[model samples]
Target: MSVIKELARIINEGVNTIQSKCDASGKPFPSLDEPYTPESDAVRIQVIADALPIIAAANQLIATLQIPAMSIIVASGYVHVSAAFATIAKANVVEALREAGPQGLHVKEIVEKIKKPMDPAKLARMLRICATYHIFREVAPDVFTNNRISSLLDKGKPLKEILAKPLEAFDESPGCAAFVDILIDESFKAAAVTQDHLMDPSTAFSDEPNQLPIQRAMHTNKALFEWYDEPGNELRRRRFNIAMKESVKFEVPGAILQGFDWGALPKGSKVVDVGGGIGGTTMALYDIHKHLRYVIQDREAVIKQAQQVWQTERPEALENDTLALQPHNFFEKQPVKDASVFLLRTVIHDWSDRYARTILTHLRAAAAPYTQLVLVDQVAPLACSEDGISDVPGATAPTAPPPLLPNFGLAGSMVYNLDIQMILLCGGEERTVLKISQLLSSAGWKLQRIARVPGNLLHKIIATPA
Candidate 1:
């Protein structure tokens, strides 16, 4: 197959795998887990294990490009080799070494064994370059062996479904093509020119730092609810929505439901889901606290889509009067009077601190005395090591100590990956506990408590207006 075809194929497969696993794992989304023992057939796992380094290399390249430019770089070789080489995934080098085994293998042998039908000369050159990074041990000039990082490529480690799908899926999607093209263009510009100048806002790039190419491909054309507004844009809208859904499948809102303590609310109190997308979190919360009156507030267009989903999937579950779909632009004042609980999920992160403060300030004013303000997003844990252990008490703890604990791998993967995504997308940052506390305090809310839920994948910072 052609290089772009192969590249797209791999990209889609990796993303799909990540998404599917997130759904299966029952967290807010899919998370990567470590492999142990032998499960499934060894050969298939070996293929994944073998593919790790190559994928890592690809991701490294992908990461270097602005999010918008990634797809284009792969499709058209739109990226410069120098930039691509710089962005290669360190994980790839490590995996390649792990595959070297005890005796190690010559570059030629490694390529033929792992990828098969290899050109000996090309393989030799790639291996030599990889050796420079200590991805493998250079036993002989052209031979290599596994090292600490390479060992992680072992089979059974959780990979997301989005990353594991067949190439045809990506090849079939026009949005994917557009997204890739723009991503590449943006990546080239960023890699060659922009990031360094970003520290100073005086630079031209700062005018729209977040408007990178990927944002154009994903949000501008496809948009979250633009289809509902324009009849001809239905396909784009639906496709965009699916991409958003796929992107966040593993980020299960239900996990937040688990962390939340409903008993703290007054018995007959009301909770409103402001700007709640698709009612995923609303449904999850409803399941958790059946007694709390739940209302959903979003744009009329989105609410139509959400109500339809609820009616088809959960007609009987949601009480007729309890859950009402209302239209309200959060930038304007809130319409609801005397709410006991005001909940915003994945909403606050979309704006700058100034605008974010405006939204929170409005909610704070609307809140009655003793009201709870629940702001839920992927609150990044304080920086921790690969072990997922943090010195802070309320941070995500390993379900059990490392080496034996499945939870350790799960928490580590999600926190690390999401942190990277948040930084790139919109300057919507994931905060540590201290950062979050300060944000809330400045917004006229106080963090009364934080609750961490196991297996669900989220922590609830229950607060009240100060």
Candidate 2:
């Protein structure tokens, strides 16, 4: 069959699966016109899984059908849409629209509600571009309302509250807004300078975190995290912290449970959460397996923040010694010498292999003979089939059926997009399983098994002392 025909068949199959699931559950198949909601139904979950290949096939079909030059031009012009998205999000347009209700508001009313100095015409244009991409909806000329995608950017705060304290705009947000803000502001800036950084002789061959495109773009000598610490960057730092916590929402609910079994450890066994920001993972684990003791480690600032959080959320854990927040750099010697498990959630992909190895070596040096290392990060896949590498035990790499890109094209683009984001922002790259295995081996750990979190792109790589 022709590629287009195959893609249409895939879409038909997926639509049928969705309809069947929705019909069985007696729930609608969710409309883009409505606001977003958390899906917990078994049928809803299955529908998402069924839809992945269809989305991939559809995107590939569009690319296949479009003229090569026009396709490239369209892709290149997406930066403008990204800028428009950031503008609307940063201006708190979503909150304004939410206040205006489903009837929507004119661009003039939106600007007035936001109490910003934005021009109504310019703002309308920005919203129009996003609406063209199916983010927001234009019910009438110069009037708009929040659709499912646009509503997700709502920070859930009153317009007045957000406007009163711009810096604290994301304080009560679910992290999506903050994540979008940071991605467009800093990550986007870094991406813009990536080619220049790569071509510059000073940083071309450099793997140092300080040599990242972000440093060059920001004209700072400090690494990305260090740059966030400088005075006057408080908002950036706060948003980043919030964004990290919000990232877990993208994973399957209870994805932490899908990985290595924390319940299997003996009661009161030590679980070191390396570079754990605000102890989110540890808190999640504590909720399920209260018998385990967790030591959440990070920079002093983050540890302080984690302490504040734990004090408010789980003071009993601190009082009973079930949880402890320790300020320790992973590159330095690990102080947790008897940990049964070292959990590194979304940590490894933020640094180059050289730095990642150093962090792991420190953990290995401090680990007990039977200690296990669990790495929660994306294992990037190649666009084509068979990424020429030996597989680790328990690792699964599923290829797509013929007529679609092996990695499922745009369905799996997040990992690849994040790979470049890491490179530009932190001199890191998302590794394939083989690369991860090799890095672990160099750091005195053997890759034991890999488990992909259901409904998420992240993988749990469990390793042991070599």
Model 1 bad stretches (over 4 Å): 1-254, 317-319, 382-413
Best TM-score goes to which candidate? 2
Model 2 stretches astray by more than 4 angstroms: 39-43, 387-391
- Give candidate 2's whole-model lDDT: 0.86
The global Cα lDDT (0 to 1) of model 1 is 0.53
Question: For all the candidates, what are their Cα RMSDs to the real structure?
Answer: 14.3, 1.5
Report the C-alpha displacement of residue 185, candidate 1, in angstroms: 13
Indicate the residue-level lDDT of 256 in model 2. 85
Question: Could you tell me how far off, in angstroms, the CA of residue 42 lies in candidate 2 after the best superposition?
Answer: 7.3
Distance from true location, Cα of 136 in model 2, Å: 0.7
Could you estimate the TM-score for every candidate?
0.52, 0.97
Worst 10 residues of 1 by lDDT: 29-38
Per-residue lDDT over 1-466 for candidate 2, one digit per residue giving the tens place of the 0 to 100 score: 8878989999899888889878887888778898877862345565667878888999998998999999999899999999999889888899999989999999999988888899999999999999999999999999999998898898989999888888888874887888888888998888888888899999899999999888988999999888888998989987887777777776677888886777889988999999888877788889899989999998887777678778988899999989988989889999889999999988999999999999999999998998999999998887776644445655657777878889888988999988988888888889988898899999999998888765688888999999
Query: How many residue pairs clash in all the candidates, one count each?
Result: 43, 0
